[model samples]
Target chain A: MKHLLSASDLTRDDAVSLLDTAAELASVTDRAVKKLPTLRGRTVANLFFEDSTRTRLSFEAAAKRLSADVITFTAKGSSVSKGETLKDTALTLEAMGAQVIVLRHHASGAAQRLAQSGWIEASVINAGDGTHEHPTQALLDAYTLRQHLREGAGDLEGLSVVIVGDILHSRVARSNVALLTTLGARVTLVAPPTLVPVGVQTWPCEVSFDLDEALVGADAVMMLRVQTERMTAAYFPSVHEYSRRYGLDSARAARMPDHAVVLHPGPMNRGMEITAEVADGPRALIVDQVANGVSVRMAVLYHVLSSQEGAP
Target chain B: MSGLANEPAVDRAGEREIVLRDIRLMGDRQAVDIRFADGRIAAIGATAVAEADPQAQILDVAGRIGLPGLVDLHTHLREPGREDAETIETGCQAAALGGYTAVHAMANTQPVADTAGVVEQVWRRGREVGLCDVIPVGAVTIGLSGERLAELAAMAESAARVRVFSDDGICVSDPLLMRRALEYVKAFDGVIAQHAQEPRLTVEAQMNEGALSGELGLTGWPAVAEEAIIARDVLLAEHVRSRLHVCHLSTRGSVEVVRWAKARGIDVTAEVTPHHLMLTEELARSYDPLYKVNPPLRTVDDVHAVREGLADGTIDIVATDHAPHAHEDKDCEWGAGAFGMLGLQTAIGVVAATMVEPGHLTWADVAQRMSVVPARIGRVEGQGRPLAVGEPANMVIIDPDAPWLVSADQMASRSQNTPFVEHTLPASVWATFLRGRPTVLSGALV
Candidate 1:
């Protein structure tokens, strides 16, 4: 793919190929020398307009592992804070001979604009935009899912996935719903009516307000973090109320089918969206998702930058 | 008025008496000849009168359909402020090119038009341009701050004779202020046009609240934000037994509310903009700020609902809400950009495409919605009159079959921020006459 701006931009074949490539790249992490010469002599710039240490570090590690020279520019303590625009920053990066730009912006469509705006010729990858898609996160989640549920099957057809909590503001939920559905997973979103956007009916997944009902036949249950900042504005009544209704506590986690896995795109609220017991439980794959994030990002950078069309 | 340094001086010294021969009047199949002299329609008949006045100019317009000049109840001529975006002269030229003879200048300008002096200056500027009538809409609030009411009585009685009062860019959200404004306008028989967006409900809203917005990650502007305000305002207007006009009704729920209010015998009138009737929130998918507007473009279902509302008379007229902004305002990121688009030049073509072509409204209905009803709402005199003998000769000759693609570079407006650019639209204004003077002749501004 020329760019990874949205998870919806990936087709079934493209998603699977990226997952398989990530699986192959994951092996390098176990080796003494965890470096590949695939992107040697190439440069990838991480242009972050938002504060995202985890995503930025993951991208940096992924590029270094692939042997690509990396440069990171955070919005804070830079020209970005002095009102330099995305265009100016991108043009400056282009002048410095950067071939690929990984962007995590606060605005929803910053990555899309960076790619289509003709400001620079570099391939753009969206790290995470404002409540928008995080394609790499979805890919890593898919990779982690494939490693467990459909190990060596190379596809995730007929798997049922239930995503619960704060679907309205979760970029992870938006990306996972799109990417997982593309891989033939039947996805159901469970959230409070206020936590769901007005037009959730139009999404591909079935929606339910009841978390227990959605957890019954699910192959995987993904818990999204509930931002407490949104709580002050009355998105929900209180943290306690939200936790009581949607939190994946041990009681609700036990209700899931024995083989069903629990996933949380992390920095999880230990007692909020998920209980400490459930989050530390055997079914939880939060740690694995983070580790796979590096491999998946490497695969994306390799595909987008190593291809002849994307190559400078 | 001297502050209008960039205003184009219109030279009307050479305006001549004209005769249009064999022009098809709207809703009539047979062609007729129309003669104009002394700023009035001297004659209109099947055959041209044998006038011996050698100075009269006669043009043979065989197939063009003539309708009363369009009147826009909503237009933003950013004068007395923000002249870099648009001035009264340029905005009038755009209106003339779009077949509009009169437009109510919105109150949301720099130095908000809340007083008699500002409205009079804007009105005089329109008169100086001589392209179209520019009636200044008085701000319902002091500075459109939704605080104290403006000088509605003074503005209504001033030289500008403002008949429509509005706080268009911002809603007069305070219920007491809205009620007082509605009640105060009743003394002068003025209508209070509401912008109808509850601020709290749409704090950081960037686009329509839907699946696309969720996926795109733009802040969702729920339809209830617009509907709830409209619902409350209509009741306020009803309680006071005063006239209320809803500006740019964009959602299906808002339509249902307006329809309900009208059915209850309340004196409420709502207008849908050309953009709301045709464009949808899907256009925001491209992240282009040109599609950004107040009361953000809704879904396809809302577009159809607004169109149906207009067709069924639940909506009274089609207003352009012709907001103009400079390049810097629209060329930035979608969230940082201003909320508006160029509409004065493309209003008629969009109305024709969305309303007339689909059989939702006949050509005669187009005249009523685009001209007569808007004129009535704004209380504009000598404009949007019937194309009959002795009426003021404010009319437009349209070639409905003529199709043209929109190009912002070629538009007369100062700003090239129209979302309709590159869109092939049906209908074209062949000629526009404002009181016997041709402001637009042969589809070009005079």
Candidate 2:
């Protein structure tokens, strides 16, 4: 794998191999050395055209653990805002010996454009893009799910997952829907009519407006962040009304099966998408999802860089 | 209107008279000879062969199809602003190579061609270039702001004599403004060509709204946004009893609405771009801005509907919508890239590949839809005339058997943003004549 741009680009075997490698790499974090020589001579560049502190730090830590040199470039307080194009930034990174570029931009298809534009020879990893796939995020989420539900085995065959809230604008939901279904999991997306996309029926998942009903038979529930701007955009009437319907409070969590776990991709709105009690509860894997993120990214960087080294 | 000179001053002295031998006119089984004198077709068939001037140039077309030159109802020359993308001279050169005799320049320049000064400048530049006749389209709203109407009467009476008015890049979404513009143009026998898009619905629309858009994570441009405006404008035209033209109609629902309006005799004409006829929304998978355009490329089903619409006369003409953008504007990410493609150089080739070769339209229908009907709708005079005695010799000779590849490097336009690059099309424009003077001959610019 030269680039991890979209979760949908992964085959079933490709996804399983990444997960298994991530699981093996997770053990290295427990060791005192906590380092690998796989990417010792490589350089990884985190090119964040948008403000994403958590994701950039996670990738930075991952590259350090793999013994790869890291260079960080952010759009804030930089020449990018003063009219430096994405092409110029990418070329600069490549000139500085960046073998892999982890890009997070505010525009959809920005990562794909970097990868396919023939402007640079670096492999592109999409940390996140505007309403587009974040393949590594989905990978770490899948790795966390396998650790909790599948006992770190093969695919999550026959497992059911319910993803709730803003499916229309959530890149997390888009990537998860593609990656989870490819692993033989049945995924159901629950959101308001206005929050769901017009073509959600074509996705390989069942869609429901009622979060309570969708949680009944689910083995896991992933809560997506609901931006306050959506309220003013008329996607929903009010935050109170949206919470009353889709929020996974203590009451809504009891509706799920006893074995069902809860997951939320970081920096959560405590009282909005999920209640405070539910986020801090024992069943929630939000904290573990972050820790697993580093390991999964290490696996991705190692895979893409080492595979290219063996090429003629 | 600008006056037409009976005898066009030819750049090359003593080359005004010529004899075209073995040219195949549409609907004729055998080839015939045509003689031109003093910028007009002097004779055809037997008389043309008998009265051939000894000093006139004699060229054999080898039975290639000859028809009146194609007329474009929509083109963006980008002069008066954005000359970095294209100029009147470069655009007219591209048009001549594409088998076009005239093109209606769109009104969305830098200062916006809303007044007599801007429109007249564009017209005069084309006249000075002397390649293809460039007719300036006046903006309905000043600066294309979609607010107050521009000086339509002054522009109509100017040296440009604009007959088509449009704020093409930005739709006149205001219903009252559209109605007023449609009614106001009636005094000058003008048509309001509308770019039908609802602003609120398509805030940042990137691609066609469908399953692919959801999967690709790009913003969806719903078909209803286009159909709703077209539906409302057709009703407005009906209420005012005025002529309306829909520019670059790109949806199946839009085709149905235009068909219904035509059935009701609302005096509306619709045009489909060659890109919409051949390309689809699936190209968005590449995330290349070359395929990105306003009224975005739709599904295969919409392609079939537009083709059927063109075949059955429900759609009136095939306008190029030949928009050119500079490298910086189009070579960036998809969202940041400009929404346009070079079309003036590849119009006939795309038409032949998509319409004629598919059996959706014949050579006769091609001439009507590309030339005669567009001229009639835009009220362009002395062009799109039938090829016969005393008619202006503004026509194109095309070789249907010889197919050529579309390479952006070979195009005359200043921009290399054509979506048809590297595509092998079915027809080739061999030669184009503007008032008996060759602008392009032997597939090269004269």
Candidate 3:
């Protein structure tokens, strides 16, 4: 609960509690003026050493909405450029009274280092680390589905979702497999051979390459955009060929059940992953995922930093 | 000479005052005086040269020897990105303290040395520091991505004028691709220095794959994983008739392969690092990440084989695969830690104490393995030299008998990642002279 380093450590109740807190936080954004004084006088720092505009901006906005002072620290234009070490940076941030740190770094286990180094007393939250997990994104996706599917609009008991893309380089797939399965939802990962990391057989989900089989009778289909830079020299035949097979075109999107919905974690390629019609269609929750990002991050920040010690 | 008024009295000394006392004279146990002036050997005699000038400096070397300046074929400066780990300036300072006059700066840095721009950046920095002559090793694969060949000809023509090419942190795994690279480098007489790990075999490998890896419960980095590639590359080198330099040769099995290639004259050279020569896999039982390295340390029996291999001329060079890492990068659980340890300042003594005093090697052989042979393998010019008149004064005055304990904080490299920090070793370097000027005096750099 202190640092969301990995999703596999979360229990069923822990996932539900975090999801429920995010729902309450999401409801505040619907008011005439979205603002809260819950985290007043506290300081939250978005210390992103890696590039993720979506995640960085979400935490920044979430901290500000709660009336907490937000400081966004990135690698560019910082003393990190001047050969200062990470522990030194964290100590400097701690000296400035940062209570929570949301960090993303390129090296694997970098987030764990910030938490364990004792350089900063701030509560840590992992935004995304190398080939590891992204906890908040999975929580938001779970919250986005529970609004319609959960019995009391709470826990997803019998829902089904499929995450399709580069599962090897994705922290998103790792986090979702843990959180979605914990909440009693069937999860399937669709990826090419090169796109899957080793030892997925032990993961708590059904991994398949046949997107057609996974698409049938799905309640919510989350299409993960392929990270192109990691492909470096062509992981597949071509982007064009990848889109022709696994992309959520009109024909594939129409194959889902009537109650099914679509989700993507934005910065989408227009004609590649999701076509223009499916992205703007009613079943798509693309925009809502962005909206939900702030709420889930706020809830995560509050849960870790706040003194609320009531439930699991 | 703005500071000419405050110059030292040694420069004022007349000709015959330059005396080389306590001379083993190429590892033969005897005393001799080799006179020199303006940085060259003037004479070799049984008696000391008289002080022809009153202001002449006296170098009283009682029980030591003389050899050529040391050369290292592999050293990671970690500049242009990870300066917290090390920089070329600091690494070169350490190299001088270790009695080296030249070292090859590897290409694995931020924005990698795949391009001519980064290679020049590193090469120019080494010159600006003026510690040692830095031979920039260009990347074989672009960005070290292992997909396509880099602009080798362009980098070879830059100010670095690179001749050694490698994807050193990783292997050029595909044999066909290795052949093409070997064939391509033939046009320019460039050597492909391979790191020699099979990618598929060492996916999660942590240490040397054997009883040690089994006991530690860490993934095994098999010895054959390195040997297999050496086997394939040696034959490939024979076919292409090009030079192939194997980086950080560990294990007795690899020693035999290099020995066979050398006997057959297949144009191959191999280097054993100081750590591999002095330490063994048994040190891994301590569970320190500082002791962790790629091409992991083998057994004591293997250590003897390496020493024997170096002596009998199977191994060509004694490179200090000096790598630096930050505290956070190394001070962690074994499996979660970084690979490599600091080597530059510790190498000479480790080589001397472990080999020189053991009668397995003399200072002459040490000079051959550490400096002369490395200079030939790396094709460095004007670095490793005999004490002759016309050679550039890239040399060192080593005590060769002063015992000293190494401390991590005493090192010039920015990172405290040395594995042999507390160990007391013999044969310390007292001073080093590069280009007729003192760079290191009394074992400290000026």
Candidate 4:
């Protein structure tokens, strides 16, 4: 609970408590004055070593709604470009009294290193690291799933979730697989053989190369964005081929159970991994995931910064 | 070869002649007295007590184990280029402290030791330091670019007398170039030491490719990248009938390949690094750059296999691969950091802890793997000699029962990048002698 660096760090109870807190905080968004005084005197620093506007803005909004002062430091305009190290930047942030650091770095384990390096005392929340984990994204996805599938149930005991597309490079896919499995959900990852990592067999979830087969009994299908940059390395022969093999088009979306929801951590590849029609369709909870992102982040900041002890 | 009056009795004017009393030699239960004088073993016998040499420094070593001086066939001095990281002087000091009488300085320096000039420079600097014999390994390709063969014959004929050629940090990935280099070295009785990494497969490899790498999200360095090259090189060595040395073998598959090649009577020798035998890829979970080395630490299963290979003589030797990098090079993020660790000072202790303590190798086997075999592979002379009368008097006394905590500050290497920091290891090198000169005594560099 000290730092939400990886989704795997959360236990079942820890995950449920964050979801419940997020459920309670979701009510504030409906009010005209959607602000809370929970973190009025605290400060959160968004130290992003990578360019991630969406995640940074989401965390900023969440902190603002909780009344915590926020400071934004981007690698492009900061001393990081001048060769100032992560440790020096962290120490500077500590001097500025940053109670929590929300970091998005290009390196896979930057957030973990920042937390464990003893360079600073601030709690670290991994906004997104290089193909590692985005705990908040997974929490928001879980919150969206719980609101739709479980309704009043606190645990997602028997729900089946299928995650499709570039699982090898998707931090969202990695985080979701970990968090969903920990919540008693059966998760299946569907990707092309090349897109799957070397050790996917060892993950808690089952893996499939066929999207249609994975979609059969799934209550939720999450589509991960196809990174075109990775295409240069020829992970797949062509984009058209990838779309044909793993794309969640309308037909494939319809093949799912009637009550199954479709989720995508945006910005979606409209014509690639997911189609425009399926992304905006009635079964799609993509917009709901973004909204839940704010609430989930608010809950995380509350848990890490507040004086409250133990599970909520 | 005793004495002109102008030449000091020891190598240096202030150096002391020492006689060790009642020290137990490795592989022998009986203790004997050893006398060192005039840069050679003056006498060694059951009755040659310290009382015979009244002026010699006398020490009683009851439980210490005596072994031949270790020789490292693989080490990166980082000199002639990255002196801020390590130099010939500092590296030799580190080697001497690690109980090494000699180390093959790798050829991946700034200008690369491709010519006689560079090789002789490294050789002369080692002599100036006078700690351990630093044999400069000539590059197989000029500037380690893997384009053309270096001046191997000139280097072999120079004052350095280099016999081992390697482009260690960069693989001679071209097959024709590798074959030509192997064939070319045959005239001089030279060996080509290969790094054995396929660059195309390990484009941005950060750690071993397995379940742990997938979970950690770091790029996977597949074992096949190393195995494929080894398999090809062993075959090439067999076809050419030349000697080949594999550097820092880190995979179970690589061990099997070497074992199979040896079974086929191929003229090939392989060395396992101390880090590979003692550490694993699980350490990368911390993402500390200290654990990030080239031919990255592998799984526990690979460690077991390599140890078994060494124990059964399938693997010929243990090399330190003592690579040092500056703080800036290793203090950054894992991807940005350099690919090596400080191994010279901790090599013996690690070997003792991983090999001897596990009953995989005895103290005699330690000497052979760390000393005798490596000396033969690198063609190093006057080193790895047995401890007896008229030997070169190059040896070390290890207190096998003593345990000491490793601290980076205590090491002689210029860079403090040892991964063994804070680890308590059994066995300490009590003293080390190079050509009858005591370079280290009472666990401190003389």
Candidate 5:
């Protein structure tokens, strides 16, 4: 969980190893047992201050499928609904004796606080926090991409993955940029200037506002959901304006390399960020990202809870 | 006669002796008698033509300008959902001090003002708070999901009587969706206020897509993302024969598109934010999250174009997209923070420094854009009225030459998210009136 705070927390070796484990877990999902005993007799709690159905459920299912008891705490109705401080909730959850806590929060550095707060002895997993990162989501996305792209357990040494859309407000984009770069994959972020965050010059990736050029020769394309709510605050103006220039309708989707696939974190603004034709298209790995979410999380829970002696 | 709930409380004992010696009214600067009565302008005329009662509350403003109270078509109070950041009362107080008589409350709230019930709740809260008239903008979509249209007729029929339906922070981006929205609102004599951004092109966008975005290593939100949407929506409005108000029109391309749309006789109106008209991408050089806005600040050319658009009436209003943010939402590194800035209190001053002072817009033009046009777009019956008898008497007195420095400490909004901190700007507001009652006196909220 402490490692879930920032992408800088993980060394290249640790990230690569996690990817490898995800591959192994991916293979295991095809087996008849489907269930893993990795975290047996333990309890994992999902503490999500943010409302993300797919991510929250994936971690929930991952913990349950691993034979570990799962406790779900969403910010919507739980003590968080009382506006009870996250600190108090953390203390309460800690008292309940949770072994691992997968947390998603709206504020950046929230998970980092829970990990470093010394409130509990549980392992931590970052589902996502603000526009900071979602290591597990990035891992699962990469895992899904690698299955179709990298063959025979080969490394993604020289491949390319282009993340397109609202990178400024996206925790998922941040995670994908760092993790993909760490694995030696060429990362390209394509977005409007208003969509990109400040101080991105030092990151290891090529930045392009032009989607047509960014998708050329790309091995994978990750489409982000353009939050309309963020725009009325004058982030950007009008959805028709956003869609006409940036919408990943079928025409733009066809511009990618034939082998390239489309990815989104879900809750898609269909016909706006992406056309229904493409989100439902054959090359779309959105559902795959959701599926791999479980496997990657299962691996994360197992590694963080069991491999305490050689912890990264 | 309404109560003093929306008026600035005049402190009886602390009165001072001063006079507005030379009142600059548009082109001609002349000596005039400006008296305050019941927290309103009881008389205004050439010095020889009018007399001030000795007992009347007198303030010396020898070399200052008095413009009508400013109005904002766009401002997010963040109440009922994120009041930890700002409230209607505090937000309106900030607006009053900034010389605003009315502000349109955006619909992107917790339960979202997509229905009459929610708009009434928000409207009642704003009225009960007694700061300024908060005109609730109905949500364009049901949950702002953009798939279904909201109850335009219902919202229009509500107590707030909302005439503007917008998914402001969220775009009604779908074409068939936008066309239908434009058509739906037209039946009720409403305008569909568009945020004008392409979602797919700008997904995860941070700042303007350019050398700066490359230098900052942040994701680029291309100018085209905004321009493309404006171009299409303007044409869409023309096709549907419905009126469209483009909110916060930034970028030169967007301005040109709006101009072309106007030339083609499309019933398209546009607005520019004080931040966009004044500041530029150079602030991004500081890496401060506060300066990092959505539609990221464009280049100087874009700034000049936005100013010109306003000057030539291509942009019809000057709205302050006042957004308040919690500290944690903006305190982190740019990549890890939310996108927004507080603009209410600093909006007029910023405009005075950037446009009014520079001659791009005279104070008369300022009154039109900031007062009259905004009221027209929002359909506030009594607000932005002519300066004559029998009106609601909403107005402001500006010490246009008053130099002031901006700091977060003076802000009334719950969150101190302004990017203009440390900015030294010309002009300060002396007082503001809502229905003949001063809500701000001597630059302080009553």
Candidate 6:
């Protein structure tokens, strides 16, 4: 309730309520005005230590649409590059009266440290952290899943969601597994054996090495972005081999049930994890995931700010 | 309040003889009085008070367990470089409070302790501090670069008489260099305490590689990184017929490898940190950098295996790899934060909690593991000796039943980065005597 740092922090009831709130907020985006007075006097600071233009703009749009003042601080040209620490940056923003901090850092536990450090008074919303949980991304992905599959009414009960590609380094996959499984969806992680994390058998989901075998009965398939850096790390021998084994092409898409949809937490590798045909196909909810991202972020910012009186 | 400058000397030429009353020696059912004079135990019997000089100071420590003063094989004082984190004086104070009479200061300081000059400077600083004997551990390679050999023989012959050499915080990973370092130290009977992490396997490693690290998303510090190096170094040590001491043996596989090496009659000794014996990788779930350490806290099974290893004499000693970092270093993100936590002040309590209280190790076994064996391994004289007549009066009195809450702000170390801040730990050290000099009295630094 104090912060939306991880998907695992959300319970069944909390996730359902947040999703329901996002559903209500989604209608506002369709309106001509698309403005809400709920966070009119509040301030939301988008603190991106890692460059993610799409995610930054999504959060900025969410805050602006809610009528809250938004300020963006990227690590690229700011004091962060000049040897300023995350604590100092966060404190500076809080001093300037930022009530909520949406952080995206390259370090895994940066957001958690900020929240628990007792350094600042702002409520922390983890936009995304290094290979760690992206709670908002998970929420938006869950929102996207509910809209196409369940008509946006209830939890994803009995929904078989199979997540594909680099589960080891994907914050999206980690967050989605936590949130989707929490929402009663049966999740399966499919990756090349090298791409899969060690000690993943303890996760609440099933695992598969074969993309085809995992795709057959899935209700929703989420493709994670496989970075070029992972290739050099020798996680896979080559792009050709990785794509051949785990990439979702037209043939792999045809293996899934007709009702099943594909989702990607983009910026995607067009030819690597997925093909152009499947990404832009009718069953692909990739664009919808982006649009729903703003709604979910608004619900999060509103929830964090409106429910509390002062510093958490 | 200064760790050294402002303190009055506890040991002086005119110091009076002292009589410790009602103290129970290790494995002893009945308590006895121990009288000290001229930096040696004068008597240890029922009639010690009658035999003592009339000017002797009589102190009552009823029912307290008395043992040879603890000696740490590995410690990071952070002095001669980063005094903002810790100095020899404060580190020794913390050591005295933790019941350690002597500590082998690790060689990872800035301007790294690789030469005779640096090691002598560190050794001299410990002498000036006059708290605990700070035996400087010489670096195996020049500046710990893992390439060429350091001035190991010169450091050994220096005033520090450094017998334990290490490239701690950076492994001497090159096998040829490792073999050469291991073989070269044999001349001075020196032991190489290797920081057993394979550098490549732990490039960006943040925590122990397992289910927890997979869940936390911090890069995995796989157990193989530690085990592989230990296995390699032990074989290399056996081949060269040199002594090899594994620093902070963390994983269960590492323990198995050490057991195998010992069974194979390899001249290999291993030491486990106090934090490793108790804390596990589960603490990484909080994402707090306080639990962050090198050879990252392993799983519960690894903990049990190390405990069993220590109990069975496979792990030779309990060393407090008490690495201290400044507040700025640990107050940030887990990955960006510095590795290591304060251990000098909490070693005994952690050992008691994880080993003794659980019935795995006896008080006699504790003396052997924490004090006797560590002194022998480091080749320290006048320490790890019996608390008997004609023996050097290096000893500690521990109240086994007294459990105290750990607070970072109260520690004598310059930095407050202890992971055990709020923990109520067992077995408090009431007093620590270094050669008849009281460095810690009534649980406070003297």
Best by TM-score: 2
Cα lDDT for residue A65, model 2?
93
Residue-level lDDT tens digits of model 5 in A93-133: 77787767788877555676567655566667888866667
lDDT tens string, model 3, A73-142?
A: 8888888677666677777887888877888866445576677755567788888766557878898888
Model 2's TM-score against the true structure: 0.98
- Candidate 2, after superposition: displacement of residue B386 in Å? 1.1
Each candidate's iRMS in angstroms?
A: 1.4, 0.8, 8.5, 1.0, 7.4, 0.7
Across residues B1-446, which tens digit of lDDT does each residue of candidate 5 receive? 33433333445343421223355543247646554444444555653124545544455556566666677899998877988998888898888888888788999989888999999888888777766888899999998999988888999988788998889887778989999999888777899999988998887777787766654445678889899899999989999899999998889999899999999999998899988988888776545577877768989999999988998999999888898999867754455567778888988788788888888888888888888888888777667766643345576777777788899999988899888888987978887766556678888987
The per-candidate TM-score of the B chain, in the order shown, comes to 0.96, 0.97, 0.91, 0.96, 0.91, 0.97
- Chain B, model 3, TM-score against the native? 0.91
Distance from true position, residue A63, model 1, in Å?
Answer: 1.3
Write candidate 2's Cα lDDT for B116-185 as tens digits.
9999899889988989899999999999999999999999999888999999988999999999999999
lDDT of 2 by residue, A1-312 (tens): 999899999999999999999888989999999998778878999999999898999999999998899999998988777778888999999999999999998888999999999999899999998998888888888898999999987998899999999899999999999999999999999999998887889899999988888898899999999877887898888899999999989998987899899999978999999999999998899999999999999989988887776531
> Sort by DockQ, best first: what order?
6, 2, 4, 1, 5, 3
Ten contiguous residues minimizing lDDT sum, candidate 4 chain B = B1-10
**Candidate 6: docking tier:** high
lDDT scores of the candidates, listed in order: 0.88, 0.91, 0.79, 0.89, 0.78, 0.90
Full candidate order by TM-score, most accurate first:
2, 6, 4, 1, 5, 3
Cα lDDT, model 5, residue B342: 87
Using lDDT as the yardstick, the better of models 1 and 6 is: 6
Cα-based TM-score, every candidate: 0.94, 0.98, 0.59, 0.96, 0.60, 0.96
Instruction: Sum up the clashes in candidate 4.
Output: 0
lDDT of 3 by residue, B1-446 (tens): 31211122345334333555665655667766655555444455643365323544556666466677788889998997899999888899998998888889888888799998988888888878877778889999998888899999888878777889988889999888899899998887789999989888887777786654543334568788899999899999999888899988898899999999989999999888888998888777555667889888888887988888988888888888898998887865455678887888888889887788888887878888888878777667676777665555556666776889889888989998888888998878876765545578778888
**Chain A TM-score, each candidate:** 0.97, 0.98, 0.94, 0.97, 0.94, 0.98
Q: By the lDDT metric, which is better: model 1 or model 5?
A: 1
Deviating ranges (above 4 Å) for candidate 5? A1-312, B1-22, B35-42, B46-55
Write out the backbone clash pairs for model 6: none
Question: Model 1 segments beyond 4 Å from truth?
Answer: A251-260, A308-312, B1-15, B46-49
Best-performing candidate as measured by DockQ: 6
